[model samples]
Target: MKIRPAVRRRSIRDRRDPLLTALTGLMLLYTLLPLAWLVINASKTQEGLMDSFGLWFAGDFALFENIATTFTYDGGVFTRWLLNTLLYVVLGAGGATLLAALGGYGLAKFDFPGKKAVFAIVIGAVAVPGTALAVPTFLMFSQLGLTNTPLAIIIPSLVSPFGLYLMWTFAADAVPREVLESARVDGAREFQTFFRIALPLLAPGTVTVLLFNVVATWNNYFLPLIMLKDPAWYPLTLGLDAWNKQAGTAGGEAVFHLVITGSLLTIVPLIAAFLLLQRYWQSGLTAGSVKE
Candidate 1:
């Protein structure tokens, strides 16, 4: 028999259109430009910050000095703010992720009355902006005598509609019905089945939701602004804003260099978290994209 003609496989370069590559390059530059500027300016002294261009490093690489001062200045209030931010992230975002996973698994796997109504409510809540509910949340907390407390921030954060929805969608596809049936047949308890089997399978989704909630809680300012009158309870975002405001006031001590460094410091953890968990997030996104 005659050999079949060789199939022409598409090379990587042939598949990548010049227009799409250019557009992607432009998007990458747009996203990274501000971060580059921030990094450059964080290395500058106060005089350099004032005298040199923002996008380039100036006299003296004062990044390390600025960092040390950021931690030690004002009796180490920056350290306190960092700790508060971590506390809020752990309690609020962590709780939200746990709840979302449980609720999402239940919604996906169980048959219950009022389920349709619950779905409708979750979808509606996701569409509602947190800012719109800020006033109402503040009033509710005020009436309960919980204002100016960490609970004020943690409570609202525990109810993440988007995270719940994300987990719900992910769990539906990620966990097969047959696996649950097999686990039940093996006489495994419901909670045991979830904790042992479903939870491991839901890792990617959980990490994704956790990251979203962490970012949201870490950068929270509006809710804290309304709820807390105590500087001791302030998270990094709120504390940083206070510092920036002080710099702007007449006769106020200008620690603009410290502010720049603090801004850079604030994002370092987020960047680390993203870098570490990026694989999980990517897997979650691409899980069902291809047929096995």
Candidate 2:
């Protein structure tokens, strides 16, 4: 009798959620529609792009040609931009993640002097928009002669207040102090206790921070736009913008197809990264729930 009542209530609740499901479906459609358009049009030649409906494929598949031209154009400058973007992702996001992990762990576990002041400042920094600091950052870097260098971009990308906060909160909840005490009793040093036990427990929070930092660093534009002038230091966002400008010129070759194709190519690696890391991400999100 009790099971029957519970099942009936669940069914009623499910029926009542149709509006929620419909809203979710609508949101998915809205987000995916632009991506679908990009893929469809990327397959078209310049003439095909102009002649055919953007939602459908053109008569000739020009995706390979567009890709070849995108890479080979201007003595293969796009390849240089690709390599530069990868370098930024590696040095920038990687260092940000490492620093956030160490700092978050210490903040969560320790009771050092001035800790409250540090926390307040970090929380306040999170409220200040990065864009608002861009001009000051540029001016500071200019004085130091770091402008137009990889260090200009990589240095600023290392700071992620939100990432640090997320990890701190996660460490507080996910890692118990009793475990640290036990490790100490077993004669393990503080760093060993952290590396062997706490770091594993903090995996999910770390991945969450890492993914956000990676995406932020990958898509960053305004800072780099102000900081860098040399084409050799250009990341993909600025490089694509330059290509876009050329496409819009009155007397230049309309490489609109290349722009669209390059845009499509740019997102592929990010999607792949998300898919690759999703398993770890999911496991991390569920880490403390089982209480094992």
Candidate 3:
């Protein structure tokens, strides 16, 4: 037999994409620059914050002292804000994810009347900026006596158009038609099929939606600013803003270091959540990419 001509495989360098590499580098710089500043300034004293370079340290290290002040100031209000933020994240994101999952799965798997209308409404709602709805939401809740309460935040957050859309696409792509039919043939109830069969395959998309909702609720300021009047109901975003404002008034109680440190502290949990859940996200993204 005649020998086949040698096939030349592209080397890694030959496969490299210049545009993607440049975009990745730009994104890295954009995301990390502020974080680098936060880390540097958070370790400095107030004087250092005022006098030193933003990306470098000054004369003294005050990280521990600043952390201590951050948690202990005003009877440990920062701790309270942290706890409040956690509560909001758990309830709001959890509810949003649950609702999105159920609604998305139903839309994808079931036949129902008004389905097209529902889809149209959801898409339209997505186009409407949430900030634009803040006034209407505040009014509606005010009439219902839900303003100034955690429910005010949770209720609004539970309705996420983007999350619904994401889960709908994911559910359609991830849960195969035959698997769902097999579940029905096995006499599994609808809810049982969803919770047992579809939910597992939906994990990556669920995590993505959960992460986004968590970040949104965690960083929420405008809604809470308008809805909540009580300090006890204030999330970290509001608490931090209040602190920053107080720091600026004449003869104001300024703890710039504490502010910097607290802001840094605010981000750690979200970062941890992303790191822990990244594998699931990657797996989910590739799960439907190929047909086996």
Candidate 4:
């Protein structure tokens, strides 16, 4: 009799809650609808885009034509912007992740003076918005003759307060102190112990931070807009915005079709990245749930 009641409760707990399921379905639809619209509209030519329903395909499929034009148009400047974006992602996000990992590991493991002050500063930085710092950064960079150069964007992106805090918290629990003491007793130097032992254990958190920084760097616009004057240096976001604005100019070529097509192209890498790295992200989020 007791077992039957317990089994009934288990089944009840396993059953899906209708309200939660409905909300989840709605959220999924909300997320997918915009992407579907983008894909559908990308297939339309300029004429079709203005005439056809946005949610459905046009009578003529022009996706391939649009893509070819986007690549070959304006001396193939879009390709340059794509390369610039990649450079920012690789150097900026990669540097940020490395620094965050080293700093976070040190903060977690080693005892030092002013550690609490550093923690407070990190927390304060994470609370502050990037936009708030943009103007001051630009002014400082201008005085240093770094403005209108790639360094302006790259240097600022190398510091990620949130990434540092995340790694700090993760390193605190994910790496056990006993393991470090053992490594020390085994004659392992601090750097070797970190590189060989702690690094492998930090994979999930590292990947999570990398993805966050990657997305931020890839989508960055305002910073690049203020930093870069040369069109040759513009990232995809700024370049696309420039193309978008060109459509509104008097006697400018209407490249709205190209703009739409370019937008679709820009998000493909991000989607692929998230899909590829989601396992690590999920694992990172679920860390420290159960006690050993």
Candidate 5:
């Protein structure tokens, strides 16, 4: 059968969506250019870093050696910092995600007096910048003799108002009241209904919240700067900052190289985490797009 001219014209128009294709390409480049540069730079030595092209790999790849030195430098202090970061990210972010999930679920599902006021407070909390709160938190922790402790970092991290808001918004639409009522009708307790039915429904939002908190805590520096003075308790961000400062002094350029390399390494876990959890985000986004 011969194709109609009008149908052929529509096909051409669809293929010629120049604005969309250009925007997509631009966004892809924006996201990927930094990562490409980091990988290329990680392969270079100190001299190669200084003398070579900024966006390309070096002739002599020292990536393996740099990785070794990064881990073993300063009596393996970098490893300690890495472990501390892992602890903070896992405990602080993970705890915060769970709390946010529960809180948001409760706010979205339950009816109570002053619910609006409580939600208003949450929105206000989200608006307040973390940096503005750091000094006051430090003073309070100092009075309690909690300064320079991991708890100082972990405690504040556990209060993610934004995560709570996100989950609350997501749960309001994602979870059906009929399902909860059905679960209750089937003899399921409230807690069991939440855990078995609601939580599973909230998986995508939960993963998104977890990833945000994890990245935020992992990269956090200002709060730690105010709360912590001991090097032993320093997370990767603070530890890298210290290394960068030392690198500025005489005979410390080697430490500078290590710091850059360490920064690159620090991001690997974040990338891995996003790649792993992105499927959940995709599923969550698509879940309500089409209705039965």
Candidate 6:
């Protein structure tokens, strides 16, 4: 039996699709190749890292040894940096998300004087890069004696205009005015209605806002570099930069492996956090995609 022309064309298309898919897979691997090298290099000793292949693992797996040295070196200052990062992540991101929620809810639900002006200011703020304000922020914190303190990082991280915009956009669609009206009809107080009714609906938005803030604060380097002089107060990003600098200098090869290992470890928490919270973000994205 001979195959039909349509069937042969369909088979050709199907075969071409696999080739296209393989090309995409290869591109993804190329993109991720550097990270793979980081992981492989992190597991090797200084000599192994210098002498061995970049893509393959070393014969002696020194991951645990590198981790120990990373933590204990400089009197376990890396642990302090890790703690500082966690504090910044929780306080900065959490506070920013809360404020974004309140601001967004207010913008969405209330009709008030100067609302347009307020929104315009927010949009303008969003356009301004965070780095542009770092110098002024440092001066302000310096006057207040907040430089070198965790507040120096957390305070700035809490003022994310992008997060506010995202929440505002989400609230405009996800939260229904009829629901708020019904709550008012039942004699629910404004705060009560917001906490009970609006907040639950805003969960997905809140999660997304939190995730963005968390990642930004975690990867923050420039602000901390300008604000903090004390190594003890360093976040992981600043600490890693310091390590990278030292690794390039003489007699720093012993700590080179530790730096690579620490860099790998630093990103693990962020990956875990996103993996855990992604469902809420995914749902929030699709929540208002369809209308009744």
Name the top TM-score candidate: 4
**How many clashing residue pairs appear in each of the predictions shown?**
0, 1, 0, 0, 0, 0
Query: Which is better, 4 or 5, measured by TM-score?
Result: 4
> Which residue pairs of candidate 3 clash?
none
lDDT of 1 at 233: 93
Report the Cα RMSD per candidate: 3.6, 2.8, 3.8, 2.5, 3.4, 3.5
Model 4 lDDT-worst window of ten: 247-256
List, residue by residue over 1-292, the lDDT tens digit for candidate 1: 2333222334544666786889999999999998999899999888888889999989799999899999999999999999999999999999999999999999999989999999999999999999999999999999999999999999999999999999998998899999999999999999999999999999999999999999999999999999999999999999999999988888554587788899999999999999999999888777666667
Q: Which residue ranges in model 1 land beyond 4 Å of their true spot?
A: 1-16, 289-292
How do the residues 93-171 of candidate 5 rate in per-residue lDDT, one tens digit apiece?
Answer: 9999999999999999999999999999999999999998888988999899998899999999999999999899889
Candidate 3 has an lDDT of: 0.88
Q: Which structure is stronger by lDDT: 2 or 5?
A: 5
Candidates' lDDT values, in order? 0.92, 0.89, 0.88, 0.94, 0.91, 0.90
Cand. 5 Cα-lDDT: 0.91
TM-score of each: 0.92, 0.91, 0.90, 0.93, 0.89, 0.90
Scored by lDDT, model 2 comes in at 0.89
Question: Tens digit of lDDT per residue, candidate 6, span 118-187?
Answer: 8999999999998889889989999999998889988888898988888888899888899999999999
Question: What number of backbone clashes does candidate 1 have, counting pairs of residues 3 or more apart or in separate chains?
Answer: 0
Better of 4 and 6 by TM-score: 4
When 1 and 2 are scored with TM-score, the better candidate is 1
Per-residue C-alpha lDDT of model 4 across residues 1-292, encoded as one tens digit per residue: 7799999887787675776798899999999999999999999988898888999999999999999999989999999999999999999999999999999999999999999999999999999999999999999999999988889989999999999999999999989899999999999999999999999999999999999999999999899989999999999999999999998788554698898999999999999999999999999878766767
Candidate 5 TM-score, true structure as reference: 0.89
lDDT of 1 at 220: 94
Deviation of model 2 at 133, angstroms? 0.7
